[model samples]
Target: MRIIHLLVIGALVFAAAYVYRIKMDSTARTERVLRLHAEIREQRDAIAVLRSEWAKLDAPLRLQGLAERHLPLKPLNATQYDSLKNLPERPPSLVRPGDPDPIGAMIQTIDASADASSVTGSVPTSAPASEGQQ
Candidate 1:
């Protein structure tokens, strides 16, 4: 009977200890959850405050005044805007057939001859004075 009583006491002590350990673990988890919730709330509030401050800093009137102070710009009146709507069309010049520009053609010929002479080690004659003058 005494051995049975000791066994019952040991079981009761173990149960009490298990309950104490479980309570401690649950309390630690609850504290961690509460801390995370508080951090989330703080971050949310900070974002809202930053958004409100950004909106105030980006107001349109302030932006226009800033532009006027820094840029070479002015508010457009209707008369100035109307002038762009009625400009006359310019007629294109006609190019005559077989009428290549003589000076440009001579320059291209001279450049080609220079390249050929440089590779072949000989001097190429330039267009004579008569051809040049024409």
Candidate 2:
């Protein structure tokens, strides 16, 4: 009976030690979590301050003032505007009169082939002229 009592006491002491260790670990983890949360809040506040400063720097009035002081640009005037009719006519094509347009020929061939394929109830699987010729 005395041996049984000693064994029981030993088991109880070990259990108490284990429980105390677990409680200490839980407390340390909780402190770390709180520290990390504080760091995150500080970073968020810094970011908000930076964003506000950026907004102030990027205001349109500030940009206009900076541009007027540093750049050689002038504001628009009523006399600067022109009527569309006053624009000159387009220049002639650069291609010679006798030269054939490869693009136009390819487009026509593709259109004709597509029409023929539709009439025959079959799709044309051939590659485009530009790719085939290459």
Candidate 3:
């Protein structure tokens, strides 16, 4: 009877230890989550500050002032503009009149071969024969 009692007490102690360990682990995880959230918030604040500074630095007036100080530029003048009629005439064609088009000759050769093949019944034709031919 005493041995049974001791065994029950041992099981109870072990269960308590397990429950304590689980609770400690939960608390540690909660603290880690809080630390991560804080770090994320800090990063967001830093990004916002950087964006604000970028907006100030990228102002158009500031950039225009910098350009005026560093670059050698002048304003436009009306005399600089010219009409289309003042442009020179286009040059003459480089190809001679007697030169035959190679692409057109190739297309004609293909058409002739196709017609010959259709007449010889070596190749099938997509178009039906006319009633007068039949």
Candidate 4:
């Protein structure tokens, strides 16, 4: 009888320990699930903030100003665009001696060089490099 009672008591203690371990495992799992839920909520809030900022940046007026500043873009005028075909062709300016018309001189020089090059295929058009200190 003593031997049977000792065996029964030992079995009961072992069963109680198993039940306690199971309860602790379940509690740990619940805590982990709650932590994940909290993390998901935080991510959603961060995404909302980012979306709001994006919307502000994408506003039409702000985007237009940014384009004007960074890119060579202009607002179209309907009347000016419609009359584009009537625009006058630019004529060559009268060249006078010793006049510092840099743009006109450059245009004349390029045209003359091109005509000479086409006429005489063997013309040494390139200027020789001068010796200079770097």
Candidate 5:
């Protein structure tokens, strides 16, 4: 064969191989996209099922029925309420108005005491000997 014919044949083979690679890559990507879509559909179906279950669980009538069956709740009577004068006096505050916050003071003391100024075992001053060296 002549040099020109051989070069053309080689170029044709290269082009065919390149086209085949591209086709395979596209097919793989298409299959991946289809798989992802199937996964998304399944997830959406699962979400729908979960939402329906939640709706059933959270229904007011269901909760009310459960409460009625399980809770020993009594109906209110007029005697349950009392005049404002009959109520107990409010207790005095444990913390004074001008006192520094006790919790804040404790937190500050803890932070000051925690000596994290330096770290140990973070790095070695010298490399350890290997097994062969030993």
Candidate 6:
């Protein structure tokens, strides 16, 4: 009967320890969650501040004032436009007929090089040195 009582007491102690450990773990997790929430709030506040600053910098009146101060004057008039028929004819294409495209050839060369570089498991590996070379 005394042995059984001792065993019961040991079990109770173990149960208490396990519950305490669980509670401590949950408390740590709760603290971490609270920290993350605070960090998120700080980041949100920073974002709001940045957005407000950007809004101030991007105000149209400020941009217009800067442009007026720095840029050369320009105002369009109807007289500036010309009839489409008066426009010069389109220039001839630079690529001659029946010739392989230079850009395409270069692209093909690069693609071939890429394929070679991608063959990591193939014959491109350096062979083992011979006994004399060692």
lDDT, residue 75, candidate 1: 73
Candidate number of the best TM-score: 5
Per-residue lDDT tens digits for candidate 4, residues 1-134, read: 99999999999999999999999999999999999999999999999999999999999999988988899966677765646577798787775665656775575577566755374544355533122111
Off by over 4 Å in 4: 75-134
Alpha carbon deviation, residue 115, candidate 1 (Å): 61
Cα RMSD (angstroms) for every candidate in the order listed = 19.7, 10.1, 13.9, 17.3, 17.0, 14.2
TM-score (all chains, Cα) for each model: 0.52, 0.57, 0.59, 0.53, 0.63, 0.62
Give the lDDT ranking, best first.
2, 6, 5, 3, 1, 4
Alpha-carbon deviation at 65 in model 2, angstroms: 1.0
Which segments of candidate 6 are over 4 A away from where they belong?
90-134
Q: Taking the tens digit of each residue's C-alpha lDDT, what string does model 2 give over 1-134?
A: 99999999999999999999999999999999999999999999999999999999999999999999999998789999899999999999876777767677876576676655464434344645445434
Q: Which residue ranges in model 2 land beyond 4 Å of their true spot? A: 76-134
**Pairs in clash, predicted candidate 5:** none
Residues 40-129, candidate 6: write the lDDT tens digits.
999999999999999999999999999999999799899999999999999997888876677767755664567555755643335442
Q: After superposition, which runs of candidate 1 have C-alpha atoms over 4 Å from their true positions?
A: 75-134
State the number of backbone clashes in model 1.
0
Scored by CA lDDT, what does every candidate get?
Answer: 0.79, 0.84, 0.81, 0.77, 0.81, 0.83
lDDT of 1 at 107: 66
By TM-score rank, best first, the candidates go 5, 6, 3, 2, 4, 1
Give one clash count per candidate, in the order shown: 0, 0, 0, 0, 0, 0
Residue-level lDDT of model 5, residues 1-134, one tens digit each, is: 69999999999999999999999999999999999999999999999999999999999999999999999999999999999998899999888888766776785566556556532545332444232233
Error of 2 at 64 (Å): 1.0
Stretches > 4 Å off in candidate 3? 82-134
